[model samples]
Target: MTAGTGLIPVHKTDNINKLKSLFPALVHYGNSDMLPMHMPGHKRRADFMGGIGKYDITEIDGFDDLHHPGGILKEAMAAAADLYESDVTYFLVNGSTCGILAAIAAVTKPREKILIVRNCHKAVINAVTLRELDPVYVYPKKCGSLGVTGSVDPEEIRQALAKEKDIRAVVMTSPTYEGVASDIAAIAVLAHNRGIPLIVDAAHGAHFRFGADFPAAALDCGADLVVESLHKTLPSLTQTALLHVKSTLVDDGEVAHQLQIFQSSSPSYLLLASITQCLALMAQDGAKMMATYSENLCSLRQALDRLATVTLLRQETGFFDYDPGKIVFGVEGYGGRDIAALLQSDFHVETEMAAPRYLLAMTSVCDTKETLLRFQTALSRLCHGLPPRKAVSFPNMETVAAEKVMTPAAVRERTWAKRDFRESSHCVAAENLYLYPPGTPLVVAGERISPEIITAIQAYVEMGFMVHGVNDRQLFVVSENMSG
Candidate 1:
């Protein structure tokens, strides 16, 4: 992430057009590109979509099946595997949720333990609940400036593995939502030495494989199972993702079996086709495309660096490593959401996500140089002669600890009852409480919530932050009448 006048400038060319020949699904729609009257119920109105309803297909004769891919779908998956350098890669229309769930279920059984970085997405929590797994949580190093979370410490994983016995798997999110990347190579070695597969939720890292300017993909770093959601950082349609199997520790057959159960029986052909076309574009044009993207990002960062009261997060900020594609900027005094609203209402630019301390702008290869410049220009105008808001920082949440009363699966079966928020302390939780953006849980199912945890939850609520799992100032806890 370069700054100052050293920003690499992108040279745009008008003749550059999207490669039209790569889309097989679009080709399957036949000559009439306007041919409609399909099953999607859009009724083939060109004005409704430009004939997108024609592309929304199911597993028809030659289109290929998601559960049993044999023809074009198999070829597409094979191409993706080769491109990603994985032993095998599956096309996931169900997003990274299906991949994470399948990867966890394939490698572990009910009641087994998995060591996971605490900053993982809520999807991991859902998986832990469904599999009834025991979790050993390792918290990340929190950023002190705004109390936001940072990358996982490889040493933390080593210590957790040494202390925990009968561990079936290890899971962590590399290049976290804040763009902090842990030492995947070191973490993978730690898990491999213990004969446990490491599952990396690289959902925000789909564009990582395009260049070394970004952190290396978890698959390239020896992770047994890695999941990437292309929609997050790539040009694919929403819900498109890929699951890569690298090490021999993960059973490929089991991954397939679990995917069959987890994903929809009828997957969307449009998403699959988009994945294929995206892979082809990246495979053929990614090197040049990424170079242009980095150039634009560098220009944006350079302009952003000139702001007096705003700070751009970088490697010198005590992070292990960072992804430049994620622009996490903080104001001297204002909250991130305030800055976000300012941009939205005044500048009409909606950002990806914002925390108390930072607002995230997800730059992609598809963003033009003009868009990047416009963002920088907006910042300059917004910051010029503006007074700083009051300096306010939330407390680091590492101390909000909970005790394990039972496995998440065990908690799922306990007939749940409601209790008022204030009296919920020391009670086993029947639900997970967390905030979005960085969806790591403040509390998960089957844990005994502490007074500190309750205080943090209340404080977040008072701050006007949305805290899931509380229904009208009440929470679900293990019913006292239920059998142990």
Candidate 2:
């Protein structure tokens, strides 16, 4: 294959066939309600003499624009909303990160108070900062045996809403990074009764509504706004996501304005086409595909359950419900990072997420029985080859009182700079420092650092885990010197 001015040559038809076979969702193209005379000048033309593929067209005439969609793009979004059973839906060219930012920006004002679960993604923290919103932290339940963060109690959200009467909205992560889900219905009811809207970060729950084993979607539970990352659990390309608006809590104009502000002007036509394709596929055979995926996931979990060294985390105890596709296993003797590394190096299987005690595997409709069997074989081998498990010392929850010191707005005003952990003990942090994979922050901006946080930071570094927003080899500490 050669690349030139928007033209390329295909040398082999087998390569194209193999690619299509790998992703059956993209193999066929059909004409339906979408008119090809608009922005995409290709008119569904397959023969692009240049290097570009057939779908690589730009906004031109009859094809409605993405930013201001009132034509074909709008119709596609409406169809997607109907499939998801939401009031309105918008295609997100950027990842869920952009949708998150836009949703937060749309509902709250500068420096306004909002309630957020502490175990949120880093994107939430960035949204809080960008919108200058204050966040009242709600600590999620902790799993002792797995050393993993679980879902937040609805009572905790109720308490925060009661205490902070001025809270404009509540932001939550359902089917969390660990695949743990909260009682979104209860939370939504509480927020609505208090005249506030609930915005759910459903980035990992794009297929929840289509699957039998998955928990009910955030929108189904009365959340005002929900963001879904289609690429995470669905058969869409990377950076393709959806932002949904349900009822009247938020104005449509405000939501549209915020989306326009956050979204890219030069959106990729390839990504948009992929979204359309994935949506159509889902509408056609999503339920059947998800049912098969669920069976595979359950079988894999059952097989893993038989292993003595590996303990699978169940959703009934700490979590209200769970997404079956997310396979989280707890190895008794090995750190999650070590187990993940071992799986990658020895078995050539890469896990989705890893923490101190838990390793996560995300199964999609694309996953095959062979893939699951391979993973099982590798995990059993690893269990037999590993040494005795060590007892990890986690900080006691009683000693760590949940503190609401600075609001999200206050945290945003502060500047962030990297400082030596050894030298900057008493200094305040201007950023949320966390270990990746799980993406839970031990320390937030403007809060006094506890010895517990310092110890966690050191432990994470020694374990060779990637810590975000910090660069020190030994330790990552926040500095008072913010001039730089």
Candidate 3:
């Protein structure tokens, strides 16, 4: 009767009370067909846990270990670090990319240099090429003519820690993923006035500190590692993540030994019981469900600001805050994947990323208002008779040339090939390309691919946008590397 007891005895102030769920072992093997020899080749069936493989589990005996969580997964990560205030919290079943590779390998070491924040998140450049560190970029400030990407200029992180020298940490990407919010309490006082340590990917801000209409949660604006992604906007489950540790200038036992060396020594007690039932439903009803999801996202941004060919991109996108559950529409003459494929073919509505001039969506508390009034009656019946589009400005994708020439540990000791980079150039790049709903790279594998990074991968392959590190249009570079 133990594996997290509760067969129904809730309300310790219910919002999923008394934090149970430490592997309900697929809810005690659901209607017990009891057929498991185990070692998950998904024998829990229901066709691969679609019905939740009878609580998809493993670490048996009273279900403890998530790399040392004691009982009830350290009381559901200390009630999700007291509902995200954080001094510690770490669950992350490999989502915020193994908590940004264990918060950039528990704060820099290898070649130590840090400071990133230019459109970040390709798991912070694969945690600066697996902690070989030395990055230094910080840019992001676009938002005008809304080609998005904003925030991060705490005096360019106090002039890159006063002209970079022995700098050790810093990384940004707050509400971004189209919600943009930086100035985490003035870049955590310019990296604790140079004792460095910022680390904030805040994975699309796991519902930004519950809410004051979003933007504050980077461990209450003084980051020292963050990484969220509770299924990107809560209601968890789907690579549920957390990883917090708010400062002590990051050393929570080397972020639990770099989350036991980048998580998954088999840890997904059903994604840690969906991140402890999304922090007990964000501590029993997250602020009246984030103030009724910011009053149905400010009445769906005043009905998408009276349509007239749509434009919404709110909170004056220069960011210091902006996450009205990340809306971002902008459609004049359409092309955010043709208005997300005309609302996924006449209103199945799906959206949450599209850019080449907007589309994003999001909203939470598991959204409803009759599916946002059937998406405001199919976006005002697909902007009625169309043809208005005159606003153009949303394409900048910052930071392209910070001059590397080498050291991503000498571009992974070269040797590569590939070619046809649209009639090549000063080649050197061997890969790190870009464009997968902002994977943000544009040449970063020992860089030098110039011709303005082959015209930004030929304008994201002539805007049909695909570009993820060469294959057709080839371009891998580094063949016996002569010299750029």
> What TM-score does each of the candidates earn?
0.91, 0.85, 0.35
Tens-digit per-residue lDDT, 1-484, candidate 3? 0011101112343223566554454576545666667656666667664755556767766778888877878877876776665778888888988888888878788888887876786778787888777787767767645667777778877887889878788788887787777778788887887787888887877776666666667777778888888897888778888888878777898889988888889886777877877777767777678767777877878887887878777766366667777777777767688888878888788987787777787778788777777887887888885667676654455555556767565677667778898766786776777777758676677767777667766776778777888777787777764544
Which lDDT tens digits does candidate 2 get at residues 1-484?
A: 0011111112323312222111222223222334556444555555655525444555545546898888667777877777776778889998988999999889899989889888888888888888777788888877635655667899998888888889998999987877778888999999999988899999998888777667888888889999999999899999999999997898867888998888888777678877887877766677778777778877888889899988787665676777767788878867677889999999898999877767888888888888888988999998888888575654343224335456545655556555676555666666667777556566676666666666666776776776775675433333455442
Q: Which candidate gets the maximum TM-score versus the true structure?
A: 1
Stretches of candidate 3 off by over 4 Å are 1-16, 19-76, 80-98, 103-120, 124-130, 133-228, 235-241, 244-278, 282-333, 337-354, 366-371, 388-407, 411-426, 430-437, 447-484
lDDT of 2: 0.74
In candidate 1, which residue pairs clash?
none
Model 2 stretches astray by more than 4 angstroms:
1-54, 387-418, 473-484
| Count: clashes, candidate 2 | 15
Residues 1-484, candidate 1: write the lDDT tens digits: 6222111112212211332222555555644454454555665455667866655655656777888888777777777777777888998989998999999999999878999898888899899888888899988867734455777788889999999878899999987887777778899999999999999999988888776577777787889999999988888989999999988898899999999999998887778878877877877777678878888887888888889888887754546667788888888788778888888888988898877777888788899999988888887788784586766766445545478788778887779999987899899998888887667788888889898988887877776788888878899999878888
List ranges where model 1 is wrong by over 4 Å.
2-24, 27-51
Which candidate do you rate higher for TM-score, 2 or 3?
2
Q: Which of the predicted structures, 1 or 2, would earn the higher TM-score when compared with the native?
A: 1
